[model samples]
Target: MADKGPVAMIDPSQLMRPEPTFNDKPLQAYRDYTIDDTDPIKERVRRTYYEMHSKMTVDLFKEKREKWLKFNHFKATVKDALIRLNEVVDESDPDLDLPNIVHAFQTAERIRHDHPDDDWFHLTGLIHDLGKVMALYGEPQWCVVGDTFALGCKWADAIVYGPESFKNNPDTYNPKYKQVSICTKKKNFVTTTLYGMYKPHCGLDNLLISWSHDEYLYQFLKHNKSTIPEEGLVMIRYHSFYPWHSGGEYRHLTNEKDVETLKHVTEFNKYDLYTKSEKIPDIEALWPYYEKLIEKYIPGVCEW
Candidate 1:
């Protein structure tokens, strides 16, 4: 990853305006899950999480880690792996219905447009969702996509679908787990504020996040000893951990390192989530730049 210091002079005027919130785009129907009952896309998203929440137990996560952490499932270059991921559509996304590759390119391009000097940041956006290839490899969407939360602990009320989504989850019946601290549904409590004001230091490593593509790619990068910096890796790993990054859950599990990582993850989340719109990237034109990026940071065929 590039240094935190500015790599090149950035013209504040040229930076693209922040992506509009869903509430700001009232004219066009965008991913408004509040109306999931009437919106088929949102309904599908809900159903996807229904399965994810119900089945993703600590034991299941451990079982999956045992299988995938070996990094022996397959081997392919970064581009090849991403193209393979193109076949997998995220069932949990209420936004666009494009190929995953398109989403990957969109994210990277948006980051490039905004932060041109930091090629590492651009690469982070490009490869962030490459782990979704698990879905193409026969993993169900329930296990591969959606918001991830910690297992072996109390479920947070602020998670997207709320505790109702975990009704059938085996972990819900466990009595040993209890809520440590929860950021209330306060209006001004954003991700950073949630971490600063309501932050807890229970230790990130001790917490068990729900098995998803985020964890898979994170472990893959670590096992192979890829050079992507810790912040970049955190962006890859926790971009979908909305319950922590967006919902303010699991603040109790974060240590000081997580507090610092949270800033980068929060910044990366804007490009990751808000870039999915009608505009698609010219993959042929963009490929050369990102291909070179892959070579620089995560080159050659890597274990999957």
Candidate 2:
């Protein structure tokens, strides 16, 4: 893990809240990825996605998994890791510009409100993005935040910015990762079209998804032996996978398990996305409740 500079603390009381339906903005108003060079924030979001699409390749995904999965980076309790998010501002997000910690509490509180009986679900929402802590160390935000896609396959048409953003990526041209198909005529003439390396209906777990905080924290929880339920874990792992869950792509690569996983991820997505701009939760007042959750499911200092 790399050294981190001082992170300024945010006072929940000082934060401004959004007003109405899905944080005052219309439901469709969120996730506006319109390309406008004149708009600084839009440009930042575009640049971040283009860079992520161009740089996150199958090989790089493998390398990142090997590196971070080692769990040798650093140690912190779940609460401490959540606090580290105070320094993270997701460049890929066009919505909410607040620190990631604010979003974490926002998501968790929303989940708790709706699913009062599911403490695990509340905790899952709180810690889903804890993997973004990699940003505080040495990882770049491009790979740490944003929607993730499978690398060893055809880029889903629904992926943010579509396939056009991946034109500069070497893996886009790599035959092994490119999706292809072939047809044969009576004379033995063959027509070929690119498909990817994975077989049809190979479970989502079998595919190599682009590296992001979602996958990192999913693996992290497993490594630390956290008792978050399978549904909660699936929610954490694939919530950022908007292409499959939200865009309705990749059915060819998913199996029965993914069918169930989709339900959980979709249920969890409401709190994650819609709650981002809601009134900031009183973090200081709320910590005790979540601390109890952390202690119950994932107590003590954990390996990063």
Candidate 3:
């Protein structure tokens, strides 16, 4: 991991932009995964993705799902889990260098600004990354953060570092894991094709996505019986799926339900990504409002 060095200071003028910008940088400037060993942030981002793409196999995905999905790790209120994020800085994120808590407030505040009546949307932004508490509890950021893609399928072209990053991944060459189709003559046998183990239009819900905080938090919310609307839960679940949402990959496997999911996730993404360089919110002052949300939607001490 590269040294984070000093936290970059935000320009006051950039704070009040009517549109999203990476501080003084353009929107295109963020999410830069360019490999450059000389650039610490770029190197950090590159290495994280390379490691993720290389090691996130179908088996490991299952193992991680089994490990985290039980929700037996520890117990805490939603607010407490979020506060733990103050200790986490996402290694996979190139844009934001501050603590995850800052980003949480930034996202929620921005959503609140735009959709004042949608309190659930505001709460969704705040807790979207709360699953990142997995980092504090011993999970690597490689698995807990970053863009997620479908496992047991051909790697999509839109993944951060491209297929080259997955050269060492065993699943990359595993015939069973690569894209395949059912054999016409033999129902039990299959032939290699472009949609892997999934049928056409299977919908995103059925796909086994690589393990990440997105899925973890989504499942965690479900396990604890959160009252957030289905759209908000979908936003939390697939917001990290940049390959599908941002890169326009995997349409062959997606269905009408995923089309609706895409709308919610894409809308949630604007606040999640572009707010990175926005003015930092006064977290201490803002907690009361968000705590009320936590109580209403997913309150009290809950299992991790």
Candidate 4:
């Protein structure tokens, strides 16, 4: 988003000492499947991830949201949508056995039959995470997932998995983080506490979440500045973070409405978590049905 060509200036070492395998952290987004045996870029993937995260800051996330979200309008036929989405491949997934396109329709197809009135909701569930395709072409895995922090200052404990990386993250122990957490009426404003950071008792639109496939694709929809059903947008953005929805990690931040929409995020996550297997959809068969669906919702030739 911040013109990586300009901003990616860092020492060669900062680029990560490339290697060939997962050392300790093996893709943790969802453990439903294993890393696929496509070529072994394991070491390169691992090192690249560290370098990206090491350099990333909260401001970077905001910049991306600003740059891309503005072009939220989608112009794609169903075939176009599928083609663009298929650009995403999951080498880290043992489940890469299926093409990435199937992953979406697999989920969307299920939702279509079960929840037609909620078809848009189903489509959101289907297409929301496709933004992870950015990693398919060599974006670092860290940039692909998310970290929890306040971009202006420091990091948060809630950035998933191993916590050691934040120690050197400049903002790790910033006094502002401590001060803000204790002082603000809008308490726990850091990315760590997602609860009240979002609008309480109102809708899911107010929540600031750890970035991920959910947030990226949601940005695509949001930047167009189209009129989104508040609940639908919320469901799109926060679907990946389970600590909030499942563990109630930041319950204090939640108002009545977030709870309600979270019920919706939860419903969507169920489809994401449960829907997948060796099974592949007949993409050719589903094309016509989806052409109508895509033509209706998206215009062709998206910006990327």
Candidate 5:
């Protein structure tokens, strides 16, 4: 199996890195950059986010937590799970319309090319979106894909499309969410006490994020007690958390552990977002190396 691996991992210093290759630069800018109604794809993306913002309330997130965290949905090997993800095309992603598997291979190969020493990182890239298989089991794309944000707290304006996109959301009517302006950091309001009461607060973990494939795969791996390190898990869990990673929101909710984990998550995001282009990876040729990595970290049938 080792004989089929790449002849030599390319060193970063020897390579030239360019922006993600794409034929339609305007339609496919970095990080879902457009929500203009003129473009059909961008319009669909906006509607998807609207649904996500409206429905992903704290109560629903808790219900999904109880349901999915059980880790008893099904069992499949790493390869099987990855292959299953091919059916899903993330509506949240404006970059590529290809199957999810292509993005997985692209991200993994990019990381492998740039950071040869970290085999675990390569595997993390491959399986990061494997939880999108939830779609096959009747889960809607709104819950399975898209950038995630905290559900219990006021929806931050930093989220994609901003808080205005959440106008019709039931959470928007709640008085707690109205207090969102206080935590928004846009005002000079010095007093923390609102009506002589402490506002809702907690660390990152205690806060319930919108349901996403990122959190699902992270929990699945943890339930199986896979050999992946905490750093790999961190990359998996928060890869879609653009609010904190990209927009620089929700810092107060993070703890010391999240601070350390942020470095790895930030590093992983480069490969995840930038590698999505028209490039098609050689799946058959690259399978052996990834097969070996899967065996090393998460062998046998993983409980989904």
Candidate 6:
């Protein structure tokens, strides 16, 4: 097997570096969002979310949070939730024919085999795209995985496949996007590259990601900081921040810290995209290893 194995074992650097990619494809990669093929089942879901977002005025956020700020009723163990969440299958797209779990395991396994010494990176292969679970977790397809950006702020032309409504945002009209904002240091918000970053908050817990598995899971992690590392949580957070990966979406927003973080994120993206194959890894074969890996990093059961 070694004879046919990848000649140059994937280094963490190779895995993170920017490359020619179409990772979020057919759904018109790196664009706003995807359609539900008008499938009745999918369409119903689409309509529900559209109505939710449309009616989800800034006021609603306050109302919803005030009511459910302490609600843990919906939360469950990761193992229990993952079993149900894994039911979300997406083979109809032309990309690959594996179940979502297989796709995730495949990404993780490849990284494991490629970067033997970099254990953290191997773990990344496992969790990096797990955020795609937003599809099965009851999130609207549009809000789950689209070009993510600062929701209330002005939109940047650099945001890959950004939403059309952002055009009407007050910040878009502000001088910053077209020119520069006198108040803000980076003109926009993120940095010219993903290399630099700011704490933005005490931790990534305060950052905004598009509403998807990434953000949802980050919520789980943020709430349980004692159980995981800041690094692991960030993996859950930025895996889908496609703007930085595809091009430099939020250049001005990044600070010195984000720059270092972006390097690791960039490395992980390399493995996530290139190692993809149609053949799903035998889950039975991988399960034991992943079970141990999960134990090492995350709580066996997570809030979902």
1-304, model 6: which lDDT tens digit per residue? 3444212211112223456542333222312223444444334433443443343233333443343334353655544444453665542222443456666777777677767876656665666545455566344455454334443333444443233434433433344333223344647654332212233333333434335556656665566442555665665577666555445655555566777677766767656555555665677776777666667766655544
lDDT of 6 at 149: 48
Check candidate 3 and list the clashing pairs.
Answer: none
TM-score for every candidate vs. truth? 0.83, 0.89, 0.89, 0.65, 0.84, 0.63
Per-residue lDDT over 76-190 for candidate 5, one digit per residue giving the tens place of the 0 to 100 score? 9989989887788888776778899999999999899888999999999999999899889888899999888876556665777777778777766665645334444677664
Off by over 4 Å in 1: 1-31, 35-38, 178-200
* lDDT per model vs. reference: 0.76, 0.83, 0.84, 0.52, 0.77, 0.49
Compared with the true structure, the alpha-carbon lDDT of candidate 3 equals 0.84
Root-mean-square deviation of candidate 5: 10.5
Candidate 4: tens digits of C-alpha lDDT, residues 186-241:
66554333232233333334444444556776666655443446666777777655
Give candidate 3's root-mean-square deviation (CA, Å). 6.4
Q: How many clashes does each candidate structure show, in the order listed?
A: 0, 9, 0, 26, 0, 24
lDDT of 3 by residue, 187-212 (tens): 66766666777898898999999999
- Compared with the true structure, model 2 gives a TM-score of 0.89
The alpha-carbon lDDT assigned to residue 259 of candidate 5 equals 83
State which candidate has the highest lDDT. 3
Assess candidate 6 and give its TM-score to the true structure. 0.63
Tens digits of per-residue lDDT for model 2 on 68-139? 999999998999889989999989898878899999998898889889999999999998988999998899
Q: What is the C-alpha RMSD of each candidate to the true structure, in Å?
A: 11.1, 8.7, 6.4, 10.9, 10.5, 10.5
Worst 10 residues of 6 by lDDT: 5-14
Instruction: Give the TM-score (vs. native) of candidate 5.
Output: 0.84
